[model samples]
Target: MEDRKLTVRAVERALDILLCFTRGSELGLTEIASQIGLHKSTVHRLLTTLEEKGFLIRNPSTEKYRLGIRIWELSTHLPVFDESATLLLPAMERLRDRLGETVSLYLRDGFERVRIQAVQSEQAIRRVAQIGARLPLSVGASSKVLAAYAPPEVLRELLESAGWPDYVERSAYRQQLEDIIRIGYATSFEEREPGAAAVAVPVTGRSGNVVAALSLSGPVSRLSRETLVEYAAVLRETAEEMGLMLP
Candidate 1:
């Protein structure tokens, strides 16, 4: 019982320290201690712990603490139907309605992409992807969009694991990723499944990382080059709106 109390106290103190910088971009040790009402030594120790765990980073030049990338990275893994998804559903539905195509929300899962939410098209001959379906991040428009924004380490790991097409050269694939980043979206025609085409845009997080991909898919005949470009513009617009809603 005593040990549990101590653990709770430590957690509370750590959370307090984290909360101190919420109102500001960064905070010094003394400022954090004063705000959290903790001793300077205790605050320093907590800061060191958080820094070691990648939850905080100390600026060498300013000697102040700021939230770290790990926080944003972790935020990307929140539950599929969490607040971010809830906020995105209506927009996805709207897109599906507008284009009469299936729309999906895909999140990166290592060398794979998982469809977390989907709005299927009403057309009798429309493309459809199941929610909670895990697909390889090597072939689809959604895959390319996620891979284009994935960290270099992730891309290297995927390549090292033979997660790319044997026909495509590494340099060419890298160039494709660069083009996706530059053009703000990706498109695939019968890349994953025959007769299917998709256009996907990156859904960025507060830190500007591509946390998810919003895609619209349909029959190849319906998603021609001109139609694909038109759909990509709409998807990019919706994705931008969705990114603004992420934490």
Candidate 2:
């Protein structure tokens, strides 16, 4: 209990020190100690730790410390969607209405793609994948588009872990992943389930990284391979516009 209290106090002191920097304000060790009303020895130790962790940067010539890029990296989460369903409803609905097919948003989850948001087509016969449905990263247009943009290590881990069948040659599958990235979109025909077809495109964040996949799906009877090109064009525009909504 005593150790926990000490840890809490240390965290509080670190936060207080961080809060001392006002916008565009840089300070030396003594100044920070004075502002936080702490002794120089204690403050200097904390400052050194912060600098080492990239939370603060020190100017070699000026010997002054300034808030560092690490703060901005953490700040990027501030505007992110807390409930993606509510945030993505409008975009999903627009696609459903325009394409007359199910519109779903799938985010990568380890070696899987989980549908986080969806708007089912109003048509009598339609594809209906419930929200939060988890599917393998190795199948479907949604998963393929996501896999194409995943970090090399992530994709490598997925391939190594999945234990694919002989029909799925690793080299050929890798080439297909390459094509998805090169073309900026992917299409599936009976990939995940028989009679199901979909076209998916990546939703890139401000950093140009794929954050999610926006896809339109329906029964092959209605959404044929021929229409994928046209639907993909629409999805590209919608996904690009929706990307702006992400943090």
Tens-digit per-residue lDDT, 159-200, candidate 2: 887455555667877998999988889999997789999999
TM-score of each: 0.66, 0.66
Give candidate 2's whole-model lDDT: 0.85
User: Which regions in candidate 1 have their CA more than 4 angstroms from the true location?
Assistant: 1-78
Q: Model 1 over residues 51-162: C-alpha lDDT tens digits?
A: 9999999999999999898877986777654666777899999999888999999999999898888999999999867776788887888998999988889998987785
What local distance difference test score does each model get? 0.87, 0.85
RMSD of 2: 16.3
State the local distance difference test value for candidate 1: 0.87
RMSD of model 1 against the true structure: 16.1
Worst 10 residues of 2 by lDDT: 76-85
Evaluated at residue 181, the lDDT of candidate 2 is: 87
